[model samples]
Target: MAVYTHVSAEALEALLARYDVGELVSAKGIAEGVENSNYLVDTTRARFILTLYEKRVDAGDLPFFLALLDHLAERGNPVPRAIPDRAGVQVQTVEGRPACLIEFLPGVSLSHPTPRQAASAGRALGAMHAALRDFTPTRPNGLGVDAWRPLLNRCSGDLDQIAPDLFATISAALDDVERDWPRSLPTGTIHADLFPDNVLVRGDSVSGLIDFYFACTDIRAYDLAVTHSAWAFDATGAPVDAGVGANILGGYASAFGLSSEERAALPILARGACIRFLLTRAWDWLNTPADALVTRKDPVAYLRRLEWYRANPGCFA
Candidate 1:
């Protein structure tokens, strides 16, 4: 989504030569996300996404991500698949980084989604979980609850710089979340980072779900919690739209209903979701280079969400 590495015309042409995608007309850098270097590549025949995996992404995990996309696409989930070259290779080396030419799915990412869009996104998430039920490849959630404290610890020294008492507040929230973290729940492959930008929508229906870099094996409800935390709130972390949250839950339930246990654990899981993003955003905010072609998201945005979830635990009820 961000362009850390620049692709030259010659290099891009050489890369395109390996595939039958025709002559490259244009390849513009996409600067929306912080994870990988992405370019909107256009050739004579079609359009595609050229993603250069960054250091944060493990090259070893490329197969799992690509295969998951293929699986989801086969099962009717709106996901982009990696395009293989003439040698049947999906992963290629670009400027010493792993890269892939991905199918370009049509639709625009919404910044402030409507309730109907939220509902459709929720339904797509449910349907994704259903499709992944039989997927046997398992990748652990690297950013799960267990990683929250350590991540926050890395950002502890600089916490007050972002906000007064931010460290203590996050520490206490982490303590509570860890103490009450769900022991058992339905687990599966989940799109752990289904933020508004990750979802592509045409009308009220989900056209595609992009960015599987964070997909992993985790508690199913936790995925819903992540989506809820993402779609239910505005950019400032205010839950000003109640219908958005309700419609998300309703649409998800219609597609893949949650168990009673999952329902009960939602509030806590939501808190954990908040903390997870809070710590990661804080870490990124503190660490990302100023000159990097990416935006440093506000860490306190998730802090507001955490406070809201704490005061309104029954929001999920």
Candidate 2:
């Protein structure tokens, strides 16, 4: 998460007063993502994350995210557990915004994940879906097909300005997605943004799965599609290593069954995943000021992958 919301030491200390997480011995702002303001909070007992929810996060959706993390963490997903304050509330207001203290998971996100790492990620991802099968609360995927066009429209001014032919390519892809989007599939809770950085791998297996803010009710296979895009493709949409896709898909299939219909819809779903990231990243890239400390991911990276997906449908075997 980003650090758009500035928390002074006094403000942080005051916020920590509500929780028994020990004194905020120290805090460091995290700059990995663009949604919320996250800080690594250190105390006498353990390390934690102090996330100040930003405008992108809806106030009403906070409980769903926190409860889902707590549910999955208890079910062996290795996710960051939401630490409720002494008052027994998981989320509170800090710096005039909804904030949370999540138990920090250990391990670094892989920059160039190996086939084994990809496989483990897939397995862990599948386990998450399985664990959440009975979680009754639901939240719609705000960035899914219905939001794609509107997001595109918001970023229309910056598409061609960012790169030539970008708008036309994205428009065509969105059209294709809407025209043939799958009507029905296996529905379940999904970590909608399980990118490489969102997963933590210590060795051969995954130590943790972070960032459940985007988690929502969606097709289980669509989660695999997002993972495929995140793990198998490079920034230029070229294959980083052969058989990587098979490794991940194989690992996922080992834990979760994929039907023939799911297999047939993989291409379109992957394309939908591509468009989602492309539009969102482009929006962030264009809107975020250059001087901001947060990392601005290249939207074109997803564009490259989208083009590749369009040209090579059924690439996932």
Candidate 3:
């Protein structure tokens, strides 16, 4: 049967042979993401994550993204190491799509992360920031302001139709955020999309983080903002048991220690973070294919977050 993504099982197995890993025992589809087709492959030795890069991910950025992960793993981060083939190539073509195998990290995502767990995520994210501080990789922020402008323009014409006042409110919010978007604030590689599903939790602990397709060089506070948007809320858009913004910040602060300027930027950056996902989900909601097994994540969820941020702008402080 044809999987929902780039290629099929038979083609993936052929590529696996190029690596040192033994025969592939089994391959199964993963339905978590809407961006790419992902699979869990069980090899003779260990499990691996196979992704067929799709439209949302540019084929060119693979080297920098993969190399950055390798760099982080080398610094003792729990990031998955990308498997290279016998020819020492980090990526290859599989099923007519650029494919790569990553060591499967074992962990359950915590729907209800404890205060300690929130703190752990904070530190882990902070540690990721520290490890990538001096990374020489240069790539434009994929989810940056310029990228969002087009979507905003698309939504503006129908603002009154889709969600009425809320749409107008978000448009205005984006304008406000742009007026003071950080021009310079300790730039580094950031996990621009750190949603809970992208994070792996093992026994109430985050064992690994997956999905670096959205990773890019940007303001460090923006990364923290993405985590805040992900880890601070429940699936239904309600606030979960985790410590929310305050606790997450505490954990992050204890780890890499945010500067006063960084701390000051958190609220606005958090607003920007809320707006970023809001626009993307809105765009995806309109664009996702009907036959796809992956359910489109709600853009309204981020709208709720934006509402929350608007009401309590001082909460970040």
Cα RMSD to the true fold for all candidates: 0.8, 1.3, 2.3
Q: Which lDDT tens digits does candidate 1 get at residues 83-191?
A: 9999999999888889999999999999989999999998999999999989999999999998888888888769888899999999999999999999789899999
* Error at 209, model 1, angstroms: 0.6
Q: Model 3 lDDT vs. the true structure?
A: 0.79
Residue pairs with colliding backbones in model 1 are: none
- Model 1 lowest lDDT segment of ten: 287-296
Tens-digit lDDT string for candidate 2 (234-282)? 7666667856677778888887777889988999999899999989988
Query: Which candidate ranks first by lDDT, i.e. highest?
Result: 1
Whichever of 1 and 2 has more TM-score, that candidate is: 1
Better of 1 and 3 by TM-score: 1
Q: How would the candidate models be sorted by lDDT, starting from the highest? A: 1, 2, 3
- Which digits, one per residue and each the tens of the lDDT, describe model 3 over residues 1-317? 11367455678778887988889898888777678777888989888888788878889999988988899899988888778889888788877788788888888776667777777788889889888877888788977876777778876645445466757777788888898788788888888888767778776577997788888888888899889878788775666654655777888888788898987887788889888888877777776687875767777788788777768767667
Clashing pairs in 3: 108-201
Regions of model 3 farther than 4 Å from truth: 1-3, 156-162
At residue 55, give the lDDT of candidate 3: 77
**Superposed Cα deviation of residue 223, candidate 1 (Å):** 0.3
Each candidate: what lDDT? 0.92, 0.86, 0.79
- Alpha-carbon deviation at 77 in model 2, angstroms: 1.7
